[model samples]
Target: METESLVETLEAAGLSPYQAEAYVALLELGTASATDVAEASSVPAPRIYDVLRTLEEREYVETYEAGSLQARAHSPSVVLDDLRSRANRLEAAAEEVERRWEQPELEAGGASIVTQFRTVIERAESFIEDAAHQILLSTTVSNLQRLAPALRDATERGVSVRVSVHTDDAETRPDPTLFEGVCVEARHRPLPAPFVALADRRRASFAHHPDSYDRYGVLVNDRTHTYVFYWFFLTTMWEPWETVYEATDPGLPTEYLDIRHLVRDLRELNWQDAPVRLRVDGYETDTGEERTVEGTVVDVRVPFASEADTGFELAGRVTVVLDADGERVSVGGWGAIVEDLEGTRLTIVDAPTVE
Candidate 1:
């Protein structure tokens, strides 16, 4: 390296500017008087003596009387060893930074904002691996491939996984075969969308596309906070998209994260007068008491629908009426208010036969 660059590097490695300059000058000089070192380096003449003294104290140089006070660069071995040690520390620090960026830990019960998109992806992979009930995701085909293994593992464990793939190009469509055994359902969205992964209604990871001017990610571990992203994924990236692939048969007993989904399926069964049983797990809306209600589903109610009506509304009130021990009880989803119970997990213990 050039003398100036070397001087700067030395300063970065824990040397004063004057000390670095004087040391470099003395190395070139072989052995020189204080006056000669100052002339060769940019260190001020008045400060050269103090700089040389400090360097000698730090063992970068040796000073002695050679007619007059003279200074010489210490053996190259000592200086080189220190520089190499600093270099090793810098390399290790760089690796640590990359590792933290790739595997950031999000705190529970709150949201974390991160600068790197990879952090969101890595966190999403971990969330998928730990998912117990459901996984909702929206991403490009390439990212789907990256997360396929995790998604497959989730499915193998009976976790419901839904994926929506989006791209800006009209002709660029993801192959339907890519989702087989990986997810329960896969949809094709004809617009560019942000990457989103919501697991079990408690954790969510969202990231803006790399092409966007402002790139960042949001990781939510709170159920209330994650609910906001769940609706975003549903309304924008999921609901309107065309289904590219869906499992031919999602055999019983099925699990649902949202009461709306459970109601949708229950509506069909109700119309057929088919007997159904469910295990509803949630907390009481008023008492805040945890309860598990398992019984036959007697009726389902929506805002503008009757028991005779089979059509379902996308928005508004949805309640599942159950008969537990011949006593009628109501179950609702997420932010349930009108219903008695705010259901979190709904498992259809016995699904009625459908041709």
Candidate 2:
């Protein structure tokens, strides 16, 4: 392949070009002397010792006898561990950059802060190969180029990886062929955005700008609802590319809508029976902001209900302040999915605030 890019990529993996070159050369030429590594890496004979010294210190290579230094790759398991090590370092470095960004005087256009983003991509690449459960990705040809290996790996692991393949070639795009042998499916959509990967619906890494992709990206792992949007967006793109239908009874109990809406709007206190002056003890199931909202409930799904918890399906004409999550809501969360309906009355501890 391209040695320059490979060297750059290895550098990204915490190797110096000299180290990358010398090691790669060793792999290509088999155990070699300092003279060999110097000639192979194009480093001057005098500087080869310095590069070898550095690589040797990092356990990337070993030297024995003057003029006789040989590079050795850590075993795959050890290499993977080492990969994770650098990823952790990059994560910490990125965190520091983010902390610095919070500084009042840390303005843009100074120092560029590009290295921080490069570390983010590094973090994403490290975690991508190990992705499990689900893979939510947004596409850009360039960003996907960096993520291809991870997606392929996830697919091989049998993870349900769904991708947002935004391309101009709508019909011919996605090249489903690209993922045929793997578990991942590349779907096409219209997003003029760089790549984003949400692995296992937990952590997410998204590129900021094309030119600066190698310079900066953000890694939001366990961040509040980053993956939720990623999942929602992926679902929106992939849900109905094909058509299907299911039948439901027209008349369902309001008790069902009550809990569903409450959970949906719990963050903003959209309890139908109440207003905003509510207690925090009434933890929001919705996670949206609370305020006075007058509108018809549009849609809802109650997974479980009993005498203590009124459960039913509710849908109607509607409008309300959507969660900061834009306009997507689908009974999301791990709150009690199935509750007793003992009282036959839905609970509302308080109402929303009068805006």
Q: Pick by lDDT: which candidate is best? A: 1
Q: Which stretches of candidate 1 lie over 4 Å from their true place?
A: 33-39, 42-47, 76-116, 156-158, 169-171, 208-217, 247-251, 281-293, 323-329, 337-341
In TM-score terms, candidate 1 sits at 0.78
Cα error, candidate 1, residue 238 (Å):
2.7
Q: Give TM-scores for every candidate, taking all chains together and pairing residue i with residue i.
A: 0.78, 0.36
Measured with C-alpha atoms, the lDDT of residue 337 in candidate 2 is 22
Tens digit per residue, CA lDDT, model 2, 1-355: 6877767867889787778887677666666788877887877888888887887777776777754555554344655688788889999999887755632131222212233555556556765776655566666555666677777777677555655665544454554455444433455665444556666445666665455435455555563455344545545544434311112222221121123344554434443444322111111333422222222323333434421343223333222222222433222221222211111113233344535
Candidate 1 lDDT by residue in tens digits, 1-355: 9988989999999999989989988888999999999999998989988998899888899998878779999888878899899999999999999877665666789788889888899899999999987899999999999999999999999788999999887689899899999998889998888999999779999999788887889999998999899888988887677988887556787777577778778766663377789888888999978798998888777777464455435578788888899888899887788788988778898966776
Give the clashing pairs for model 1: none
